[model samples]
Target: MQRVAIVGPGGAGKSTFAQALGERTDLPVVHLDRFFWRPGWVETPRDEWRQRQSELFAGDRWIADGNYGGTFDDRFALADTVIIVARPRLACVVSAVGRSARFHGKAVQAAGCPERFQMVFYRWIWNYDRDSRPRLDIALARHDHLDVVELSTRMSMTHFLESISVR
Candidate 1:
C-alpha cells in the first residue's frame, strides 16, 4: 500500500520490515529515527520534530517506520496502511541486544546515532506491552479508517511479508 506506517517496540524489526516493504512496493522509505536523532543521539526539539514530520508526510507515497509516539498520530493520519510488529517482549529484547552487538558504534536505523544498549532501553522493551500497547490501541481505535495489520509472531510477520505482491 502507499503511504504505509510501520510501528512497534524498539526491537520489533520495524526498520527491516519497512525496507523489505519499500523494496517490494517500490515506495520511498522514511526512517523516523533518522530524522528524530541528530549527531551524538541528541533529539530534535519537539516543535522542530513536528515540522520535520509534517514535511515527510507531505509526500503522496512513502513507507515510514518507527514508533515515535509523539508524532504517531500525524503519521497515522496520513498513512493508508499501518503495520504493527507485535512480537513477544523477550523476543524484542533479544533482538535489540543482538542489534546493538552487530551495529555497535555504527549507525543502523538512526543516522549518526550509533547503536547502544541501555538498561532503560531494555526496561522499556520489557514493559512495552504493559505501557505502550494501550496507548497504541487507543490510537488505532481512533484511526479506524486506516487498514491495520498486526503481526503478533515471527511466523505471522513472515507470512504477511510473503503475501505482499509488488505493483
Candidate 2:
C-alpha cells in the first residue's frame, strides 16, 4: 500500500489510522485537514484545493486521509489501496466532540483552524450515515479498480495494520 487513500465520516479515526499506517510503512502521511482549512476554519477555494491535492498525489508514496469527495478521483486515481474507517455513528460523534474539546480555542491539528462547538458540525456527524454514505459509496464504486479495506473496529484496525508490510 504505497499510495493509500483513507475516507470516512468525521472522527472515524481516519487521520489516526493514516498516521499509524504511515509510521509502519515509512510512507509520508498527508492529513487532508491540514490543507483543507485555513486559519479560523476557512475552507480553501475549490480550485486551489484540487490543485493542491493533485500535487500531493504526484508523490510516489503516501498515506492520505480525508473524505474530500471533491478530489476523490484525483487521489483515488493514483492510490493503490483505499481504506474506509467505519466506526459507529455514536462512536464517531463522541470522538469528534472529544477531539474538538481537547483542542478548544487552540490550533487544531487540521491547519491552524481553531476548535469550537458547532451543532451543525455535530449534527452532520450524527446524520453522516444517512446523508453521506450514499455519496461515499458512489465514489468507492467509481474507483473499483483499487483495493478496498473496511475497518469497523479498533481491533480490526490494529490487525490490519500489523498485517500490512511494516518497515
Candidate 3:
C-alpha cells in the first residue's frame, strides 16, 4: 500500500490529476480543500484541519491532493511518493480563470463553493502566482528524497498513469 501525494499551485490541475489517478488505482483520494474549506468557502480551524488530515493519513493506501502548508510535514512523512503538477504562471492563471468562469453560477457539487473572490478562479489565479508556488517549493524541498513525479502537461499526466498498471 502506497500513500501518494499530489501538490501544486492552484489551477495547475492537481485535483483533476488526482481524480484520474483515483480511477486508475481504485484508492480513495482526499482533496485537502474539502478538509480545509467549510461551506461558504470559510477556512476551517487549523486544529480541525490537522485532525482531519491525521484521520485521512491513518489509512494505509490513499492519494492526497493539495498543498496545505500547515500539514505538509505530516503528509510528507506518510507519503511514499509525491507528484507535483506545475505549469508556467500564465498558463496556470488562464486555466484557473477559464475553469472558474465555466463553473460559475452553477450549483457546486463539492462540499464548498468558490467564495466571493478567493473562489472566483481568476482571483486565485493571481493569488496562487504569488503564494502557492512558494508553499509547494517548501513542501517539495522538505521531502526531497520522496519519489517525485513532476508533470506539467495533460499528455504527460496520462502517459505517466498509463505506464503504471495497478496489479
lDDT of 2 at 147: 93
**lDDT of candidate 3 over 27-108, digit per residue (tens):** 7898887777777767878888888899988989999988786677889888989888876657777776676677775434
Choose 1 or 2, whichever is better by lDDT. 1
* Minimal lDDT window, size 10, model 1: 108-117
In order, how many clashes per candidate? 0, 0, 0
Model 2 clash pairs? none
Give TM-scores for every candidate, taking all chains together and pairing residue i with residue i. Answer: 0.95, 0.95, 0.84
Cα RMSD, each candidate: 1.1, 1.1, 2.6
Stretches of candidate 2 off by over 4 Å are none
Using lDDT as the measure, what is the rank order of every candidate, best first? 1, 2, 3
Alpha carbon lDDT of each predicted model = 0.88, 0.87, 0.77
- Tell me how many residue pairs clash in candidate 1: 0
RMSD of 3: 2.6
Where in model 3 is the C-alpha error above 4 Å? 107-109, 112-130
lDDT string, candidate 2, 57-151, tens digits: 89899989898877787888899898999899899999989988988988766667778888898898889889887887887788878999999
